[model samples]
Target: MRNAPLGALETAAALRRGEIDVRELAADSLDAARGVGAEVGAFAHVLEELTREQARTAAEGIEDARRGGTLDELGQRSPLWGVPMPIKDLTQVAGQPFEAGSMALRGNIATVTDGVAQRLLDAGTLTVGKTSTPEFGMPCYTEPATGAPARTPWDLRRTAGGSSGGAAAAVASGVVPIAHGSDGGGSVRIPAACCGIVGIKPSRGVVSPGPYSTEGMGLATDGVLSRSVRDAAVGLDLIAGPRDGDFMPRPRPPMSYLDSVGRAPGPLRIGVLLEPLAAKTDVHPAALRGVERAIELLHGLGHVTTPIPAPFTPQEWAAFMPLWSVGAASIPLEAQQEGELLELTRWLREQGQGYSGVDLAQALSGVQAIARRTGEAFSAYDVVLTPTLSGPPAFPGELQLPGGADDFGAQCAFTPWTSSWNMIGNAAMSVPLHREEIDGTELPFGIQLGGTRPGEEALLLALAAQLEELDPWPLVREPSAA
Candidate 1:
């Protein structure tokens, strides 16, 4: 009961030692979540009584396991025992209201649980609530018409990059230590960079997105937004693996993700990418400073770093937009709800609807071609490091509507490097390694490190954890202190 907001490992050990009651821990988490959450607009729903009930159930089960002499097995099965985990509104949770940050289906309830979400519960995670996201998760910004915009703790007026914006905001603001996030075209990593947290997008199939989902353009996959690499690894372990009828399935990782963090990745070759595919803007000085520091740190740790060429052509990059747009229109939005969509969503959907089946197929094939090309180049290097975004968090509505033009091309300029990992189905992480004062304000910036292949996920985690140890960022920010 004494630990107010312990880290993932500390929380589990505390729960095992009976030093803290699950209900109290959950209550504390909910209080913090709602307290900072109110101003940040992080949650769409706070499953209050449901969270308490879940904590009570897990607490009783811990005692039951102790009496039955199966405590060690329980520990092995549930390493994050009774810790709080917030569900991103992008995923479905059975019986929970889920509209995905839209007014169209505001009262719709999830009839079946998403596979990634179920695995979290089975691992004894105390589910706290749901984080807000963009409508149908089409945009990288997180201001939804149904609720308030999800804002950065560093500057409330700045954007909390999305579609996992609320998840990043809550985790970054010390509301919860870790929260579920999804990365499709940099949704997870983008927000993390904005808020100064770790966001890892696993290999496409490593985490399932099933049981009623259109997230399978092989783009969006569930992950975690956390303060530390180890916390993200704990989340990956709990959620990784295949479901019974998965869209994209891969073999289990060679080792538990949690175990990989403490193990060193060893010396390796690293590539630095400055110009991202299709991006026209020059790299922001703040962003370059963060990744430059990362390169220096890696050099100090005995790794080689050098410049790398951009892998995709302008034509290949152009095709991805239509392919992703086709996926957006593929979703079965009820005819009645059609009028409720944002102008940007409706316009994108219309563009997708105009494409012939052959056109859509060609677009998907083009995307795959680009992915293959990128993957081949990645094999030569252990890791490719880049700035997670072109710049620090932009002002909240700068790229959003209400007088804003919905030019995705312009938005993509801000986050050109991140989505390519999604296209290639590689594991990537945003490490908060740099902070600097600009225009009389100091904000955090992230450096990205991505794996060449699925098996390289462990190496990526180990490397990120090593960086955190060598030059750690503030784990979390409390709004009260701000």
Candidate 2:
């Protein structure tokens, strides 16, 4: 029912990927990517030399392992086996530029690989580049001063939502089959929805975030955007784990994510919310239709769907802004660096700076309280369904701050329901199940399925895969010349 052109690797389809060697896949991905990266503005920095070097090494490793007959286990032994992908600029990769899409950190390079990047690299995938993101990932849109806005493949007129926007565009435009993403507040799923793909954000502790963590704010976690639900499940298997000294790692999952695909998630009770929670603007009609369609589909799948109210009152959502501001306070900015930030970022940092420690503690307390209350209410349901975005992909500049409606206002209009999952530390996935016409043009929108607090990642994956089978999206709609 959904179309995937360009970046749809659908890793699970490797079963019958035309007998192409993984090395050939890497070469094809790179070749298809060539100048398209620049066109889509999906890359902050392309690791050209490193990619060629790594691809060769990976190819050799696969060949040697096959010759040695020691390639029994994949992703564990040679999981990636020469596949190529990009890491989000928000995270660090050893020897790669880590600009975080901010001019303020323009010259910075990472000397250490983060948990997500390290896991992917170990799984056998070659990191081809770093994808673009918004400055410090503060906003839900991806137009930075460093490059053109990250535009969706479905239409260049609209933005690929930030801060994982570039990764979504890159994957959507066929630069790679999959890419790393982070969702502090729907960054992964927003862009995934905008670009028409699968973006799965594991529960906060499922994917480790060290040698750095937000001290368990439970707001952000690493994730992946891929062509299919199965591929998303594979990504979780490859990247979800706890690092040494990781404070909040959940108990190791009872089963690997890949095993969950095609598994039955017996008749789930789902609470469906069609309204754009906490936002002042009305949800675009297209988004509402998408949710309604998802509800219908869920019913056909033998799941119970019921309308439910948002987790908290509008006044309670006010606490989220102060907590959001706290993220700005965490960036290590020198006076000069601070001066160089975009006005919205500067304002956010300044606003963050003005909050006293007590104010921050209180805000966090409020946030936790809201999460607790939501958890209690949602305990009755197996999952909560909402539109991943309140509307279709927005045109460039529609959600930009300072020049548009208030940044907070425009952001809420575009991304009304995503952040709440982050606040509650839920496992969430945006599955591209329908297309909606916007302003006379048809584009894809996603239905978000979120697990409860202390979430069930496997159940969510299994349910999504079942939906994918019922409503299969194209793996790669218009891959360039073979």
Candidate 3:
């Protein structure tokens, strides 16, 4: 039997106390990536040689710190030191494959590392490989035509969720304790909920989107997928900061996010909304039950839960679709390369091309209006609660539909509650608080928590940590080779 893996924080602590070395930890992680990760199709690439070299370098650096009597300080500065994690394929790591889950870019390697990837390297994390994402990260599912489908370790037939689906699978299946993920529109949180893990989507501008910030109109930001809230918080601290040319850099937090996890958030007003905001689909009972459980937990913890109207409207969603299509259209591709694009990507691109510049401007203005309305509505509460998805985890290929409205509509229905927070530019997370047996397999269901204000991730983390303490979720699933 394979041994359970230690979480990011636990691994860092062990390295600090000399309980384990970085090389050994990296080896174990690589083993899992090659073994269970392959079985789950969680990794798009595995850099065994690069990982081994990094482990040696990291182990040497730790030894030097120990000899200099600065090991404690090093640990304090880089909380994720010696941790093995995978970066989402959407982010560039120089010399690594930068396919972005598209067959057209299959052999392309990154020439320059993205700002987020550099920050992770500075934190002393060893990158095992790139996790799978959907083509251009336009879809919510991660069944890329370039490689294997990223499946949930909980059930191989089910999707891991995307475009950070592979990252969630790796974390949930013990291939790694935590993995780097990005959230454009529930990409991180959707997969986290599906795989029974924690996903953190920081407020807009909290994490820099440098070197390529204009891609998603600032809707997408890098985040983390991890087993524990504290791990996610530590991850936030590692990568949350302003770059030299950020469009709208957020101010630094008053305290470290890890510190916030321990502080008790006093009783505060939490608004619960069960209605689907953007999609005109009925919320599934399983999804509603997850929110109901979260409400009960909040009540028991001394916080008040009140039902609130959906702050977002269908009209705003109509405006948002054009912007999303425009994002897909913005990708620089050669005319001849268009045929290499996925059906969904091509459809979105075509839709984007059909919109006039006037239409694009109108859409942008509409998005701003939606953001203003959402901010005003959410100001009344400390946090907002909803189901992470409108339904349970989907089976492989279940969400795929014919190109155009059918595909787009199916995506929205599955992830009705997530994109609104992206539009609002506020912090949000998916916390796995409930599970149910489906076809004899226990599948995880998570509730979404949105912070009232931008850069309020600390508040969300505090509540998630409290809930974890009261009724802890499993850290990882049993050893699975699919």
Please report, in order, the local distance difference test score of every candidate based on alpha carbons.
0.83, 0.78, 0.88
lDDT by residue for model 3 (283-349), tens: 7788899888888888999999999998777656777887889888988999888999989999999
TM-score of each: 0.95, 0.93, 0.97
Candidate 3 segments whose C-alpha is farther than 4 A from its true place: 1-3, 479-482
Residue range with the least summed lDDT across 10 consecutive positions in model 1? 397-406
Question: For this target, which candidate reaches the highest TM-score against the unseen true structure?
Answer: 3
For residues 298-370, what per-residue lDDT tens digits would candidate 1 score against the true structure? 9888889989999876556887777778887887888998899887788788888889989978888988888
TM-score of model 3 (CA atoms): 0.97
Question: How much is the lDDT of residue 11 in candidate 1?
Answer: 77
Any idea how many clashes model 3 has? 0
Q: lDDT order of candidates, best first?
A: 3, 1, 2
Ranking by TM-score: 3, 1, 2
